[model samples]
Target: MSAKRICIEKDKKTSDDDKVQKVVINSLDYDSLAQIFMLLPVPERIDIEGVCVKWKEACQLSCLPKEINEIHLFFESLLDQKQTRSMRMHGSSYEASRELSAEVLYTIFCTCKNLKHLDIVHCRNDVAEIPLEKWISFQNLQYLAISCNMTPDLADTIVKYCKNLKHLRINNRHHIINTALKTLTELENLECLILLNCIKLNKESIIAISNNCKKLKRLEISIRSIYDPPSSLSDLDEISKLQYLEHLKLCIGKSLKDSTIIAIANNCKNLKSLEIAGCSAITETALVALTKLDNLQKLDVSFLHITDSFISKLKGLKELHCDFCEQLTEAGFIQLIKNNPDLKEISVLGTDSITIDLVIAADQATKHRTNGIILHIRKYDLELTQAFKSIIKSQWLVVK
Candidate 1:
């Protein structure tokens, strides 16, 4: 054959191969293509739209699953796009730069209408940067977790827009006064509210929340600073009004007393999970008060001065953490375990009383039971006995 003829045939073959490749790529089903795109890393997923016209169309059609509820922008840089010459010259510290970042986040929120949980912890700009009037309301937003300097305006914006918000977590290092909390009372459907390091959250705010958010089922308030006055039992009386409260975690600065626990037990009969960890003021009297919560499933009384008798009363307890409890003895611990057969996990890591023998004995006693138990014990050196080490290796025990 002639050389010119061969060259023409080679070009024809190349064109045919390209056509076959395009046909194969386009043959993939929409769902399969969407799943493939969803499996890619966030940056790659965003870039997928630019791959080809077909891929771009598929990417747009791919609605994120409803179960993909959580949106975490905490660690990631909000300013991913290229900055203008002016923004670059001024640097990110400027208000304009932060506002630009906020706009990018606002775009993200606008896109994710199906998001039930949104966590924008440590995001540069305040949530208010996203104009409520222009954007669609987050009706499905149930859980909102923000860790920043909270203003009353931000609280009002959240309560105003996120009407269905059930769980709200605020971990602000700066003081959030009572007036800021008053805005949250408007969230009538609010079931769980967690306030950590908000020192200025006073009795009035607590009362406001109790009175308005009657549907609250879980409440966690942790006051880490001693500079703020301790919340007395009388101040916590407002919590009793939340009759439906089931899970309560109070890590106040040595303010939890017998009366506080008694009030909770008397009012919140539906209590299932109770955590009073680091409440050093609590003693046997508080434990007696806790016994009233017959349905209590999880209990964390770490660093409290409670005895074995306290554990014995919680017969239905499933998970218990008694770390750093110096008062709990080996016999008492063993007796507590034997009494609470329903116990699935127990942590006694910082206790000075628990011995290797007690752990081994408990394991042996409970091994016969159908569902096994997990015991978290204090860390020991390499010199630990082979028999005890074997138990740890078996995943039945955790040493830490």
Candidate 2:
């Protein structure tokens, strides 16, 4: 039951002589509320304004139940994990989402002293940049993915104290300049770095990461040339410095070229998963060159131009996402489905060639497979969707 309902139920048993005593209980005195809260077997979310407000406030003071060590707010699969919904109603002890304000965050930081992983992607930007001083309370803070502007204070605090931080994702920040990156160089143990929609990704900044973060294994960053990226084809060779790099995704719209892909294939030989979308500058040769990555398993070339020849050339790929590839016809993908027996997933959203017939064809081709192949497509018809709900997981490309 909710904390509010608990209060109402507890009210019926209170004695009339305990009226003043009940005021102390109703007002939610810190010590009294904490004691009462501990007595309850399983009190639900204390997200309320009444005595439960004191219950939450008391949780901040007591810091007893450090069970909740993770918080996911406005979070979804970055790509290829779960494409069903854009927004997830997720939180701790509460399934509904709440405003990720400084006060709410402070309460969480103070309450869950051992919070290890926090993902606040798609949070409101109205609040001021989060004060990193409050973050010191998290003794076990490791994975932090947030959408906020990077400031000197934020960078300095991260460089100084956040030693255990492993996976860090900063999205839609315009201040990821060379200075901020220089501070991050202090985090030598950093393994995974994902910079989504960072408008200031440039040659110098990219070089700083490639030159310093040699231990990096996964890197996903968007290249915005309007924010000062190099125009030449060979400007991205610095990416080859990370010999340990396994998974790499570059969101360069029109600036990505074939030479850059070739360099990554030649240098980052251990690359297993590679995703490049909106790279209109390169030819189908880029897809053909990716065939050189022997370890490549997952590939996402969404919103790119590719023909039947390149699609046929790519072999041994386990997962492929070719959403909006106008030239990727039904015959081309079915051939791919029949060839790669170990193929796991294939997304053809926004492709005109996909139909019920193609779905039947793919199912028939993979009938002898050990593990089933999941097909992803747009939610075009409700009746049709209901008909194949078990076979096809209908994911809407345009999320609400």
Best by TM-score: 2
Question: Candidate 1 at residue 320, lDDT?
Answer: 86
Query: Runs in model 2 with CA error above 4 Å?
Result: 1-38, 41-68, 74-96, 100-104, 107-113, 122-134, 173-177, 223-226, 229-233, 355-364, 371-400
Q: Model 1: clashing residue pairs?
A: none
Reference-based TM-score of each model: 0.72, 0.74
- Over 301-321, each residue of candidate 2 has an lDDT whose tens digit, in order, gives 888889777777777788888
Report the lDDT tens digits of candidate 1 across residue range 1-400: 9999999999999999999988887899655676666676545555675677557545533433433556554232445443211122111111122222443455446665766777665566666556655335476888887776666776777777788999998877677756778988889889999888755566677678778989999999888544336544466667878889889998985666667778888889999999998888777876787778778889998888888777767777888888888878888878777777667777776666656778677776566665666655443433443446666433455544
* Cα RMSD, model 2: 8.4
Off by over 4 Å in 1: 1-69, 74-103, 122-125, 132-136, 225-233, 372-387, 390-400
How far residue 206's Cα lies from its native spot in candidate 2, in Å, is 0.5
Best by lDDT: 1
CA lDDT for candidate 2:
0.66
Clash totals for all models, in order? 0, 0
